[model samples]
Target: MKILLVAASAALLGLASVGAASAYDGTNCRAPGNCWEPKPGYPDQVAGSKYDPQHDPMELNKQSESISGMEARNAQRVAHFKKTGEFVYDVKKIPAE
Candidate 1:
């Protein structure tokens, strides 16, 4: 009876360990090919800078430009499909200069 109890306890412990390990596996950000590494000195720069604005306007401008560019490309694709009655799959023709 004692031997059976010991074997059961060991099995439970093994399962518990496996569950714990799997829980941590999903937490790794590098699981995907794209992972961001923080640039050196970035934290110190942000800490030292005065708060002129709640957020950086340049960053906002870049985001706005990216959104607008994507919208324009999508519009062009829709227009081409409407005119030619075919989907645009060519990468060269879809990208905006």
Candidate 2:
């Protein structure tokens, strides 16, 4: 019984820690239209982060707003997928420039 209890607790802790590595803070979504696309398994939004480059709408002002912005943002998202092997959400934490 004792061993079983310990094993269960350890397993639960491990599972909880797995998805906690990468998280969005939600501070980026302050603007009116700001938002983020959530990954399949990760949480939709973090407490203090928003405007994830991966999932957020990046281009607002442009000649062809729909076409150009989408193309550029999609290209960037694809590149990110290649590097991380996972899709980024709109609430993604931006890396330091």
Cα RMSD, each candidate: 11.1, 21.6
Clashing pairs in 1: none
Best by TM-score: 1
- For candidate 2, the per-residue lDDT at 46 reads 61
Scored by lDDT, model 2 comes in at 0.65
Best by lDDT: 1
RMSD of 2: 21.6
Deviating ranges (above 4 Å) for candidate 1? 1-54, 94-97
The 10 consecutive residues of candidate 1 with the worst lDDT sum are: 44-53
Candidate 2 residue lDDT tens string, 1-97:
9999999999999888876754555545656567655565665566445544454444544446877877877777777777878776542452422
Off by over 4 Å in 2: 1-63, 91-97
